[model samples]
Target: MSESRDRRAQFGWAFYDWANSAFATTVVAGFFPIFFKSFWSSGHPAETSTLQLGVGSALASLVVLVLAPLLGAVADRSRRKKPWLALATGLSVAATAGLFFVGEGQWLFALTLFVIASAAFFLAMVFYDSLIVDVATPADYDRVSALGYGLGYLGGGLLLAVNVAMTLWPEMFGLADRAAAVRWSFLSVAVWWALFALPVFLWVKEERDADTPSAGQAMREGVSELRRTARRIFDEKPVLTFLIAYWLYIDGVHTIIRMAVDFGLNLGFGETSLITALLLVQFIGFPAAVTFGWLASRWDTKKAIYLGLAVYAAVTAWGYFLAYEWQFYVMAMVIGLVQGGVQSLSRSYFARLIPEGRAGEYFGIYNMMGKFAAVIGPLLVGVTAAATGSARLSILSVLILFVAGGWLLTRVDARAAPSPE
Candidate 1:
């Protein structure tokens, strides 16, 4: 059970990020909303459609928020993290592949599948995050987590580039038009995601704890353990404070990532600009995440995270005034500079705080906070836009979250955790 660095196992784990990021970049952030609004919800008003999209995202996140902790607990107690991860990933792949059949005017079907796929994606991540403890030691957690995010940027970005080409130049691909190309792109993600997930499934081993009770007893004990876990977290001031800060700041970050393209669309920015900006974020994000890993080794990890939050705050402020397409590109680049940094650091930082055997349970709580934050960010933006009838104003509201999160983060003691072992 030694947590020595194993390059093959490490790469296997990191490849999962490469595998699933296709869904994040292509389907969720890039084309799906565009397709949903222009095709599926064609007849609906802009405000109504955006609101509905937010509602769907919120619902999906909420489902994950509720279930993540329970499943994480189960995975830890039974030492069945891979099984849970496999189940979630398999279902998500199926749902993503099914998107090929959701033609125009099928908003209900499209949104339903999106929700199912998104929830599965986020839930699967709980197990994946927990596995960091099982794979890499605490000393290398920052590097390892950053490696995964970097691969996510590169892998997701690469596919998105191909998707953009297929969408814009459908004739070259011998497709009917952009819509047909988009359909094929969705199918491609299914294949890409499932294919790259095999390495981890084949190579990484899930270390089981000492002989536990029967399955039924383990589940019951898991529930009891969750109650104690809650109390333990509350008693750990540093972890509690960090979670609160993360909950607030990441809400703003996720909101911006999820809604940036739609907001630009509402401003009448052309599709070319929005898509190109997304590519910029993805490509820049790769190096930026790796750089943050190095920074964490020099500057304190928490300090580096603070710097990322500062950049996010600036991005939020700039988002309010975004008018020209070039301005959007600038903002997107700035976001790329810090997006992966903050998220990767947060995961590694949290990994250092939790008890070793309870990694799944603790990371479950971490994922729940993230899922719950996702719920709020989208809802907030949608409500603001619906009320003001201006997407620009909605972008400004995210600033409050960053400001609050940063202030709370200053109170967290980065070195306040017991030995993770």
Candidate 2:
């Protein structure tokens, strides 16, 4: 019965990845840029629309960076991670659903909704990630994290395929045209995201603190706890070094994910190839992500992550030389091999380092570091593209981040350091 319950809980937790990935694949990655340029910001130059999108993304990341640690600290003190997750998820769903109503020539309205939805998505992930400690043991962390990411790829991919079909063959779906189909696709994402996310709130239960403090007192203690967590993180050299390494490489990884489709389009690769490439990533990533987990169990976690970083460095270099659709497809395949492994191992590895009671606070910093990378990645890519008048050169510029991140990763002592929090 205990084993059965654990299995159910684990699946429930993993489904959140399935649920939320609809947003990641369909909205943010697959369709949003194309929709923004072709419809919402129609008549605007592609470069202008791309810069605007970057600004909106940066704004969303800034909000998450400011709020992640504070809200995480409060949730830690209140023992209310699930509740906060629910609230953020709700906001995200609502904002995503609202996107269906954003008509053409309303780029400002579109940006507003996108920013709100993006912020909510990032905020909810902090709570969800902290729950990793509650659901699985250290021994299982790598496998379980990989499972979550694998399922995410599957779920996100499935939905994106449907959305792509809708865009390509709207009349078959009883829609008026591609525009209407895209709008409905946005609505479907909201439903899919909300429906799949329900299992986490329903089936997974988190242990609560026995002592209840007043709201004000909890806030005060949370601030103090935040300080302690920060000190603990810095004082522990291994984790700090890993985070610095993660910040740099993950920035490059994220930059690629965010800009890949846009970069391809800018290079005159038509929309079909870009969409096809997106689907390819989702399917390929699922198995590759799981393979990384198996590798981690047999090998050192740090070593596995280093291997992922090395692949990403190569992927960036390949991106600089991409001149054909086949090459883009090849790049996507390589990305699938390493993306999930690196991210999953990093999360599970960090979970092993943090103290038991402060997972929320510590994961807050983890998420913040991720969001901070969002800010830097887009800015770096956008500025480089703007300055060079060539997106290919911009791809080359990202190699610096991977190199620096890989070098710093070597500095982190492979021994797991105990958290003093």
Candidate 3:
């Protein structure tokens, strides 16, 4: 690839984050939980709806956890990451669009679509993350990865703001009511995701090697590769430790993202306040993510991550005593400062630890760990809320994950070379 083409590819690749993050912002973190409880599971008790949402999220993570590593290996061997990414994106778009048609009091059906959309969304990321190696050299990984996340925040935030406006004043948008407006938001996310996703497929070229195998052979060899990668992860202490740390802390992050609205609802905060706070996170996250990338370059990547984790720990602790709507906004601002930073830096940092020419397989494991953590985090909050019947107590469960994960991160040697095959 020429120099100009490489920059285009990087931009195209980063834009996928811009594309799919609409689903993250508009559907997953923004309106879905509010709508699911108030609209879909209208009569259910608060705790019941929380548990249902948690189970749905866990189920989605479980599906991706099982499939990501193997699918990644097959894509790596077949040299077809883009096609696999396309398939996942298409499925996710369809599933998200399907949500627009789900009727009131159809919580089960709504949850089903959400699970499909969420799973497909996560699976697409496996290929998306792996493709970083094709877009930039090792020296540029931190900047390029952060660029994608920064764009994600900007793009997702922009659409979410529009969606929020539609809901706040349904009449202005020609909608019948707030419920109708929320449903339309789901449709908008699907269209936005599909429309922006096109650029990546058109402009970003997947790198191929001469040794790429036939479909049948790839499937057979992919399973063999999975085993080797698993063993390799174990033999490499730094990679193993970093993954374990990521698993622990990221669980808290995922839990917080998925459950924050539910937590506020349980504490009697209004829907408008909760949604507004989420928008705050997105806008603030845009500049913060880009700044973290620069900080990692000038300071140290691991230190930057540690700063994010420390703030998260404080946020988790403060959440237990959250009283007023204003405090929630304050927490959102604090979280916005570090949310994208922690997540983007983790990706770039891990990219440094993995072997070349096998990003698909390695990032598969990386995403698998993330999904596995997702499984645990939501379930922990759900089970705690259900058993104890205390939303405040449940929020405290995440503090341990951040603390433990941060401690374990100290064991990792970020500068260590990838372990040889």
Most accurate candidate by lDDT: 3
Estimated TM-score per prediction?
0.90, 0.92, 0.91
- Tell me which residue pairs clash in candidate 1: none
Task: Please give the lDDT score at residue 328 for candidate 1.
Answer: 75
Candidate 1 or 2, higher TM-score?
Answer: 2
RMSD of 2: 2.5
Model 3, position 59: C-alpha lDDT score: 97
Candidate 3: segments with Cα more than 4 A from true spot: 40-55, 105-108, 256-263, 374-397
Q: Write the per-residue lDDT of candidate 2 for residues 6-119, one digit (tens) a residue.
A: 888888999999999999999998788779888999988889998999899889988999889988998889888899899999999999999999989999999899999999
Residue pairs in clash, model 2 = none
User: TM-score of model 2 relative to the true fold?
Assistant: 0.92
lDDT of each: 0.87, 0.87, 0.90
Please give the TM-score that candidate 3 achieves against the real structure.
Answer: 0.91
For model 1, give the 10-residue run with minimal summed lDDT: 1-10
lDDT of 1 by residue, 1-421 (tens): 4434387788889899999999999999788988989888899999988998989998998898788888888788888888889999999999999999988888999999999999999999999989987678888889889989989999999999999999989999999998999989999999999999998888788887678666787688778888888887888888898899999999888888866777688779887888898899999999999899989988888889989988888887788877787787888898898999999999999898777688888888999988767557777777898999987788788887888988998898757774544
Choose the strongest candidate by TM-score: 2
- Output the lDDT of residue 316, model 2: 78
Query: Which of candidates 2 and 3 reaches a greater lDDT?
Result: 3
**How many clashes in each candidate?**
0, 0, 0
